[model samples]
Target: MKGRTFKHAMAAHCESGTLTALLNHAGLKISEPMVFGISGGIFFGYFESKKFPFPTFVVRSRPGQIRTALARRIGVKFAERRFRNPADGEKELDRLLSLQIPAACQTDFFYMNYLPGHVRVHINVHFVVVVEKRGEAYIISDCYSPELASLNRDSLMKARFAGGSFAPKGFLFYPVSVPEAIDFRKAVWKGIRSASFYMVKLPMPFLGVKGIRMFAQKVVDWPRLARDTEHLSHEIMKINIFLEDQGTGGAGFRFMYATFLREASELLNDRDLLEMSKRIMEIGDRWREISLFAARIGKRRDLGPDRLRELSGLIHERADAEEIFFKELLAMSKKKK
Candidate 1:
């Protein structure tokens, strides 16, 4: 394997970062937030998964959706394939590399040696780019890693084939063709409209702003649902870590979305969206406060149901603010149209 002149940059989220690098390599020169927002990647979902010991909270759409949306919106032709055999997947990736194309693949972080031991988990939706192969090792650019790292072929295969939810199955994707020009305005409008629709029009109670409210209600009842103080503390810690420590760009992806909104505002010359962007940043701050409070509760282990209820009330306020904000955004977009 020879050196390829691909520019590798760090980013906040994996999928968005991978897309940003891929598009830049293809001469698009877009930022991560632009890729994220224009792909309608921001949203919320909360549910109890039997596969896990606790509930699940997600701040963005499921994996692969952002890549698909970004490709379609910007008129980039791409191909994604999942393999049943790991050897075949390796051959396919090598083929792409031979043609000077960087390939992005989904893998489990637990097998990535660059991550801290504590942070390594069996998360299979993590995405990374393979830029070059040096004999037995593959040079990878993982967004979450502090710097680029190399993994031996055996290690890369293990990460790609890790068994669990959202299993990678050696999935690989790359843009086949890119347009010379993109309809930025149309893409931005379509992206914003889709996000607004999901936030304001989604009927599921465990999605959008409604999901926040529902989760807050559940938080209020944690004492009654848990068997003891230890159980309640564990649950609080889990929620706090998921919101504050996960690769959400801080505050459960609210900060990232705020940045995207600010960028979109300038691109579209819409001051209203700019104001909303500031408001969303404030919301992200509020979310950080909630996480801090949860951490405190987890450590002290003395917060009663009434105290928990107060925290739940704060979350309710956040939900109310988000609900109003999304509705206003949708109305503003419609008026502009």
Candidate 2:
């Protein structure tokens, strides 16, 4: 595989970052937040499964959907290929690299050597760009990493083919073509409308603003419902850390969405979105405070149900704010149309 001038820039999230790099390389010059928002990636989901030790909470859409959604909305053509055979997958990646094309691959963060030991869990939806293959390693641009890193061929294979739910299965994607021009205003309107619909109108209670409220109620009941209070506290602490400390660009991606709204406001010359952006930023700060409160309660020796209730109240407040904001956003979008 040959090398090309692929620039690596740090971003808040992996899928958006990889798509940003690919689009820029294809001459589209898009930003991470643009890719994220235009694809309607901001979302919430909470589900309980026997496979997971505790309830699962996610701040964004399921893996691989963002790329597909962005491509469909922006008139770009992308190709994704998955392999049951690792050797065949490597060969295809080599073929693309030989053409000097960078490909995004889904992988397990546990196998990425650049990440810290503590964070190397069995997360399989992590995205990285495999730009070129060196003699024994694959050059990658991982968004969370400070600098470019190289993964050994063996490790890369393991990461790509890691077993579990949402496994990559040696999948790779790259943009085949991008439109020379885009209707930024139209795209922004569509993006905002779709996001608002998902947040406010989704039927499932375990998604969007309703999911936030549901999770809060669960948190409030943890002390009484949990069979093991210590284990439950630890799980709650993990949720807090995941929400605030993970590379979610703060407030589990509310700040990222707020930035997109700010940009959209300037692009569309709408002051309403600007005001909503400020309000969302304030909400993000509140979320950060809640995380801090939850963390403090997690560390306490006694199970503090009252503090948990306080945290629940804060989440309920956030949910209320989000519901109003999205409803207004939907109205604004309808007016623009």
Candidate 3:
């Protein structure tokens, strides 16, 4: 959501069916299925993925669900933006996923509906091949090259038709055989990486893709951010106290902001500091972004100037946070030089 990286966007493409067309349209001889997991969302090979909301389809696991895809389709939830938590930094990771599934219909999907258990381990990855009914057997690896960008239509149709995810590569747990689940994670992920900005922008902000945005908005969206920041400032102060609460051999690195700032100052460069500064401002941008949203809503009477000032204070506090990052970064950059 915050940054636009190809890895982050791969799920959207696979979920959306765009990748199928891209690969299949290329006239490759399609073969097998890829295992993209289900129920619990799955993240493929990349890290640093931000959360994405997709319309989820909840299906009833009835025995004959797959016979008719339309009979198997369930409810879809429209995802709203969710915030990012700072505590999530540098920790054990959770995967991010987005989807573009047919609301109802099927040869490949409507199968999840008939499950008795809530967490069905439908395929873990996806199996994809682009076989031209009788063509040169050009596989999807048989399709787009980095230099070629985009797929031709005839091949796309074939890939799309055969497209469906498989279980992880080299895993023996497949309930069904995909025959070949190779080379497609990258290809499918590549397809996801190509969607339009507007398509992912809303998801980005909500997903808290930009930690800086959350960091910034933590103080700015004071509609809630204000109260929460107030609580966080108190809690972080508490946690800071808690960090030092335990017994210490006093052998490990002492972690004071001052120490971090001091060491950081000696470690980075002007360019790095400038890049850091640029990034800090992006957080600051969230304030204006929200303000613009409010202004467009145009409820002058609904949002008083006092409320606006309070919001301004919230943003200013975020600026203060940015200022802290900047000052520490600048100090380090100077030291590094």
Candidate 4:
């Protein structure tokens, strides 16, 4: 197979984007927003562990759940594999590419040399599709990249085998089949319900809307945890990057989910959903404000307690808004049932 044969397109989030591309390549047309929404991809979680460099938070569901939940809901079959040895993984990927198949791979972002240096963090859950091989390089379609990119064999291997939290372990997957017909209406509602349930119903304090609250409460203590003022500023500015520029489709996926809701409303012809979609868009705007505020304060080196307290207040407000939003969404799900 020749390199660059697979069509490359950028998307909001890597996991859902890869799934959308695979499904489309298999002749099952679907939008990224639909895939994301139906997969229950929006979520929040706060973490402070010794393994991590500093306190952090997540704005989406656990890695790989999007594909798993999507397959179950939409009757798609994907062939998945994980390798204990990097050489074996490379051989398998080559075999697939030789057959003109595009395979999605899990890799640590730090080793994707195609990315800009500033964004090359050690996130292990980044997804990209290897389309073909040319000499010693693999042509890849990364949702984060605006166009097709190439990674050498050594860098690819290192990325696939990178150790730490959420290691890829040389994982790869491809869509084997998709059903001829699908019940999108049912799938949308189920997805919304699942997202709502995970957000509002999760018992853990550090997950879901509760997790947002924890983030709000803990952010005020970030100065104490940082190595210095500059460190605190960097972490604070990361809030903006995580929410907007990190392929979240803006506002930590609130905007994308709003798009999903609007699309679902049109498909289901439900006025209530249309209204809720508008509401969520407004909520996303508020989140954008928070991101901007964090960026501004951090860039200005305004790490005083008073500024952090103000930031905490903004997060707390978002938490309250999300709690109400998810609860109402859960109620709406019941009515749909």
CA lDDT, every model vs. true structure? 0.85, 0.85, 0.25, 0.93
Candidate 3 error regions (>4 Å):
1-8, 11-301
List, residue by residue over 1-337, the lDDT tens digit for candidate 3. Answer: 1112221112111222222232222222221111111110111011122221211111111112111111111111221111133223101111121111111111122122222243222332222222222232212211112221232433332322333343121211101112233343233222122211111223443221233234333433333422443442342232112122211101010122222223222333224433543544454354344444334323332333455455445544543454355445435433442
The parts of candidate 4 lying over 4 Å away from their true place are: 1-5
Candidate 4 overall lDDT versus native: 0.93
Q: Judge candidate 1 at residue 164 and give its lDDT.
A: 78
| Higher-scoring candidate on TM-score, 3 or 4 | 4
Per-model tally of clashing residue pairs: 0, 0, 47, 0
Model 1 ranges off by over 4 Å:
1-4, 223-231
Top lDDT prediction, candidate number: 4
Candidate 4 residue 159 Cα shift, in angstroms, is: 0.7
lDDT of 4 by residue, 214-257 (tens): 99999999998999999999999999999999989999999999
Whose TM-score is higher: candidate 1's or candidate 4's?
4
Candidate 2 regions with alpha-carbon error over 4 angstroms: 1-3, 223-230
Evaluate model 1: give its lDDT: 0.85
lDDT of model 4 at position 91: 94
Candidate 2 TM-score, C-alpha based:
0.95
